[model samples]
Target: MPRIKTILMAGTALASVLVLTPSPAAAQSTTKPKAEEQQEAETSTAKADRETLLDTITISATMINEAVFDSLSATSYVGDKDLERIQANTPADIFKTTPGVGASMNGDDPATAINIRGLQQYGRVVVTLDGARQDYWRVGHGSGSFYIEPDLLKAVTVIRGPVSNAYGSGGIGGLVAFETKDAGDFLNADEQYAISEKIAYESNGEGFTTSTTAAIRPHQAFDIIGNVNWRDRDAYEDGHGDEVRWTGEEVTSGYGKATFRPAQGHEIKLGAIIQRYEDYVTGSSGSTSATLSRYDADTINNTYTAKYTYFDPDDRLLDYAFTAYHNKTKAEQTQVWPTSSIGNFRYYDVRTTGISGHNSSRFDWMGLAHTLTYGGDYYYLEGESSASHFGQGEAQAYGGFLQWMGHYSSWLELIAAIRYDGYHLDGETKGTTTTPPEDESLDGDQVSPRFTVGVTPFTGFQLFGGYSEGYRAPGLQDVFRGSGAHDTADGYIPNFGLKPEVAKSWEGGVNLKYDGILTESDILRGKFTGFYTKVYDYIETDFTITPRMTDNIGTARLQGVEAELIYDLGWGFINLTGALIDAELIDTDNPKYKGQPLENAPLDKFSATVGFRAFEDQLIFGGQYLAVGEVKRTQRSSGTNPGQVDGPAQYSDAFELVNLFANWIVSENLKIDLAVENLFDVAYTDPQSAWSYTSDVEQGKGRTFKIGVTTRFGG
Candidate 1:
């Protein structure tokens, strides 16, 4: 508590000093000539055209809309053009080149789990669609997963690390914000309506996808958009030309949005999304044994949202936005393999409802341009499972935050924020003869603070640094799980007294933006970041004792460096991204096992992409190369029995892949795309995948060819 108070005080004091400082630019602001200002605006527009990447604005980092390149924290943006160029088939594909980000997915399941800076699962990383949180969890051999169709999204913004604490609670690792497509994305300014149809096919999986989108502007104040997509795929062969079982599935999804403008400054948007998946999944996600359990699974997800905003240039005090949303995810499975459990049914469901609102007021304070923002958010989650060992529970979280952003002399900027978060969890566990049924509950609260400063010492370069804190409450499963036979050697004991995890992070970075560096029409933009984070009360499963239980393990330290760079000339572009990370678990009761590398940590990765435009920008082609480092892990033997081998050491070999893509604009209403993935047909496994085991790492898809065609028309 004292530490929290000290941080708050320091932040407030720093903000005051920065805002009160006088600057020459502020005093001379009114003296700038109109002709010079106009020239500056034109120069900005010309620069935007030259930069092929990160041309979009991002609102996830500081809640203030700004270009990703200008953000002080490590942030990445994927716009509609990037999405179209990638032709992503899964959520993982969308982030292939993003630094410090890794995704793990089971071979048979469409769900995905994201890892950031070696931290993942149980709300360490927050995923949101249209500002609605996706809270779904199921007990398995790997990390928890979420479902989202990449086709429905128009943009994705990623904010890495706890600097995003103001966005919400429990995002100690990072935040991934997804923005769905709307009427504005498809309809032109002068068009009243429009329709688009797209069809795509893949060779390796024999996959096919059909999509249709329609947008209409019935009145000057109202607009509506709808889209439907269906996709099907067969089991795909690996590089060895052997089929990977349960790798195929069918998916259907639909989305709709209606926007209303009742007043000049007020707007409202109502949206709905639905997705259904049918496939065969395995009981043990990563296991390679032939006798592993198999199940026929059907999953459905739905989300509804309403958002309202009021923004008027004349009213600086009323730049306000509010959103309310509800989401539900349900899955049904029937055991089909493993004779003993054949015909058994399992069901899982989770419902999340949340509301968030914020208002920003801008004004000049003490010769500085300042913005003060305040907001509060609340969310409730309920989950239930038919599996005996999986617990049923309810959880609620609420938080409020206040932030101040100040700018001086067009060269210096400062940001300070404080947030308070509280959570309550309650659940019941199935008990055995040795342990009676018990109802458990827990509650906790914390205050976290953040501060950042940036200085542009030169015209095209900036140096920035910040310190932030984040909090994550324990999950319901961690507190309520209590189903095990006490007499048996294999059992899990429930620990209701578990503590929440807290993260303190420090980050520094440099941003570079230059135009006409080498040629008359060339651009270069890049950001390099280094970060270190220490987590207190890190939670993990403890196997040192009989009746293994979940507990607060100890402190964890993670440090890493990430880099992203893009260079664009008129005819061609080059993009590069890479990350190097090191992490360890420390302060453990067992000294011999201390300082071991954390399990499931992603390996070092680097990517490079080069592309060229031809035929007056109508034809575009590109190729990408990715390299991943190797990882090796040795399982620790049981403490009770010394020198006993628990399992073989896990190892994943280093690998490289190359891909090529092309897009051709045939006419105003027609376009075509082609891509080849894994061009060399390399046989390798992703390091952090659920199917990556010591004996047999799941083989990635072999060389695959994809093609798509789209036609659009409007009246």
Candidate 2:
């Protein structure tokens, strides 16, 4: 493709950035430079200082401690301040400002599913919490969803393309990693123990939240931290002043961690987390018409992990890490049907266990610097359903990879990596009508590869590109679960011969930084990316024959452009972000669906924010504007055999929103935050929502007021 050739040429001219320390001689020479040369010299000096600050912030998603601009991938980072500024209680709120990313809320459940570049569901976009994969899902009329509490998160990292094959399998859509706070994040250098308390309230939902955290360093080599949160809320009113039933919920969460250093170069950590949610939902379809049956649901998620690390800068081969973890999630629903004898029942359950380890070595050969990383991982999963009888299956998968990074010169860097994966499944249903499992087996394996090249032509600019491949094995549900119960595709059966999904992707991007561009303290950073991905053997529901099932769609393509900018104007900062995505079913077995736009693919999105600080940087204020273009979709058929619907009449309307927030540090130990969402009370429906197809669509939250207070006891 012409795009690929252009990116290759750019890569050959630019190189990767590895933040380096400023030279003492260069710093001293800045004072002696002439007036005409002084500005350029000072700019160079400031660039080094700013780059050092960025490098200190490590990104856990990539497993490398390099600056964000140094990689040949599209990435973004959100810190604690950003989270608080948005008053984000949901994943949609947290990612509202991010480009090329979309989130869908599962009705009144408060759980969320992620979409990246029009690909999602069935683990396509890998999500992790504290290095442990979150892989629980259920087939429903709405989008498949996952769970995670935001109150415990300290930071979030998002990689928006298949350029991250070395991270894991089935991440063709992208990766989202959440990191929890440690004692070090709360305590000052001289403080050994600390306690923080927080309380918050929101008017629209009549929601109240309380949180407490304690950190203690009992000894020089040992440290521990614990956190607990409780929240209660009532149903919230939408923009039309009508209460959205089943929106009320009660939640409780707990987290604990302990770290110990046994030697000068060895460290170990043990961690555990638990979350419980109690709510009453009026319907199973998550639709306004589902009030015929009410359900009282209890959801629980638990995880535990142990990790060890060893590092010695003097030894080239000693940087290593090992981890073992277990996670379980269960959702039980008690239904109150008008005529049912058994009023209570269990809904769904899933459990997972895994172990992984990796090591890296750095050395110099000839004139090039090389770093080699290799690791292996294995996981076992079991899923069960009580009342619905969706499926009962046991599955496992294992994989390993070897990656090498070489710095050939100051202007060129290269990366090559490959991974091998194998998976096996057992248990299957008897017939299309029956949901009972019978003995059945399936197995498959594949190898995926990645190659990347980065070029840096100057101190503040980088151009990079990469080509990578990704693979996704069919999940147990795709092969073992009988779909007869669903109304969409009647008499749906299971297909044991289903093939694995694969993707070939290409990406090219440029990052520019200018420190002291106009003034000594001014800084500007911008990044732009162009990406294209072609997925083969794409999975979709089939309705061709009597026994409807899942089969491979020939091919689908997704291409997009994303841009982000941040400018520091000495007194405040301005940020701008935008994305344009186009998705199409290029080649399918059914010619009628060819050239159709993929579901949930929004055409254009844009966001802008302006923020400033006052009172010696203790007080901050910000405002944001977000706009989204119309989404093209296939409408549901009115008949029992609703084969396929596509055209211009199936488009959803576009919408825009405005929000404002403020943060004030009253004192060294106390702070307050306030935010107003949907300031104009505009009625809008997210394109990804299940109810967006109807004229009487469910509206989003109206003008809402939120306030929070935090107090520190000791540090």
Residue by residue across 425-485, what tens digits does model 2's lDDT show?
8876555345554678888888988888889887777888888888877777777666543
lDDT of 1 by residue, 299-366 (tens): 99999999999999999888999999999999999999888879999888989999999999999989
For residue 580, model 2's alpha carbon misses the true position, in angstroms, by 0.8
Instruction: Please report the candidate that would top TM-score against the real structure.
Output: 1
Say which candidate scores most in lDDT: 1
Q: Residue 526 CA error for candidate 1 (Å)?
A: 0.8
TM-score of 2: 0.90
Q: How big is the positional error of residue 158 in model 2, measured in Å on the Cα after superposition?
A: 1.1
> Candidate 1: global Cα-lDDT?
0.82
lDDT of each: 0.82, 0.74
